[model samples]
Target: MSDLIHKDPTCFPVLEAAGLPSAFLDAIMDGVLCSAEAIMCIPQCLDALCLNNNGLQAVRDRNALRCFVKILTSRTYLRALTGETPGSLSTGLDELMRHASSLRGPGVDMVIEILNAILKIGSGVDASFSSSEPASCSTPLWKLMLTGAIR
Candidate 1:
């Protein structure tokens, strides 16, 4: 059906299990990317990314981290911050550091939590632990691990 083929799916936090329709996907993707700057706030957009198991899955499943990487590594932002394309990680960090002067308060707290999660994952903590139906706890451990990377 045309409607199904061109479904205007909402972006993250309202994900579709069905993969995107190839025919019109690029337009939708471009639209989402165009609006990404508005959602760069740590407490708002990134907060939603680190919310829970569903959120973690969304990041892993939806390739949200890659999207962030692209946004952060874009040439414009990189030039604004670093003046040259140093390398991969450096490119992203350059953009991340662009806002370094303004990062504070809750943003700082959020970054700390993210760093902790990244450290745990770096130190052999399983990144996908919670998605496997592990325990009876209200929260899943895997999500906690992903908080750093996705957010």
Candidate 2:
């Protein structure tokens, strides 16, 4: 199932039809923290899933933002950012921006609040995306904000 999603994210509807939306989302969220390969595959999965009405709702229903917060806050994700190119990270931010309006609701307020905090902290610093050192706990968070805003 993870392979299928990685191979063809457009197969989302089929997976949903098979009554596996929860499982599919779980795979995506969990995969993101597993390794660099899974991290790179995530933007494509999000692009395919969040672009459609049903798929977007499924993600929202799953409180996917909370999952995202968990991912963003994880040491693994920060390590990936500090050590590698921000390929999927940038693309994933783009997808999030594209779906920003659609992804809003009471359930998403927490995400919004987090973003606001990032913005406040980010507004104070000129973050260098080229740097490999993790500046602080919020370094990745601010980088993500700047990346998303730059698009």
- Highest TM-score: which candidate? 2
Query: Which model scores highest in lDDT?
Result: 2
lDDT of 2 by residue, 50-149 (tens): 6557877777776665555545544446665544546666666566657556664633575676676456445644343234453555465556555454
Error of 2 at 58 (Å): 0.4
lDDT of 2: 0.59
lDDT of 2 at 97: 51
List lDDT for all candidates, in order. Answer: 0.36, 0.59
In terms of TM-score, how similar is model 2 to the real structure? 0.53
Q: Tell me the tens digit of each residue's lDDT in model 1 across 51-100.
A: 33454344334433333333332322322222232243344434443433
lDDT of 1 at 111: 49
Name every residue pair that clashes in candidate 1: 130-142
